[model samples]
Target: MGTASSQLDPEVTEKVSRDVNDLISKHRVVIFAKNICPYCHMAKNVFIEMNEAYHWVDLSKRPDGREMQYFLADLTGQSTVPRVFVNGKCIGGGQETQELYKKGILQNLLNQS
Candidate 1:
């Protein structure tokens, strides 16, 4: 089955894009996730284990969640949840986060301010 249409209205896409950009710029770590996603929990747990602070948007609880997901896919080339960004760059999702952590590179990225 094909993915759902990602063509949101220009104004809406612009607004969502701006909002997402603002979040990335304002926070050292940002995770775009769905509340019930296990991968989301796994990704967030890494930060918790390291005692690091992060900002997360639970898209499942937001009115524009689907749009945001679509926007994230467009930005990161992944339509999955737990899209984690650190140092204003897409580090990828849960599995990728775990991999980075194991490689010790995730710490280096977090150290950048």
Candidate 2:
């Protein structure tokens, strides 16, 4: 007797969670966001423009996406859309993301880890 968001398929959730964790763990950079978010688009564009490698989690249809969002909020202490994680460290939202790119710290972070 729970809402869809609270009743996600355990297998699917596990798979998605594993995929996300793997991307973050194996890769140097990761971005989590909804597809329609403008900031998400901007962040992606910046990465593309810089030719940086990154993984993206699109939560537009996944039932447990809200759960993932909550997890990000708890992990990063901010619930902003397009939450970016660099080498398992939360680098914050869109503007901060851009600033890091501008300062070239983002590239350095990727190079280090």
Flag regions of model 1 displaced more than 4 Å.
Answer: 1-6
Poorest stretch of ten by lDDT in candidate 2: 2-11
Per-residue error (Å), model 1, residue 68: 0.7
- Give the TM-score of each candidate: 0.93, 0.78
For model 1, residues 29-78, the per-residue Cα lDDT tens digits are: 99999989999998999999889899989999988888889888888889
Candidate of highest lDDT:
1
Instruction: Please list the C-alpha lDDT of all candidates, in the order they appear.
Output: 0.90, 0.77
Error of 2 at 11 (Å): 11
lDDT (10s digit) by residue, model 2, range 9-98: 677656656766776787677889899899988888888988888888887766767877755665567766898888888788778889
Q: What lDDT is obtained when candidate 2 is compared to the true structure? A: 0.77
Backbone N/Cα/C clashes per model: 0, 0
Residue-pair clashes, model 1: 0
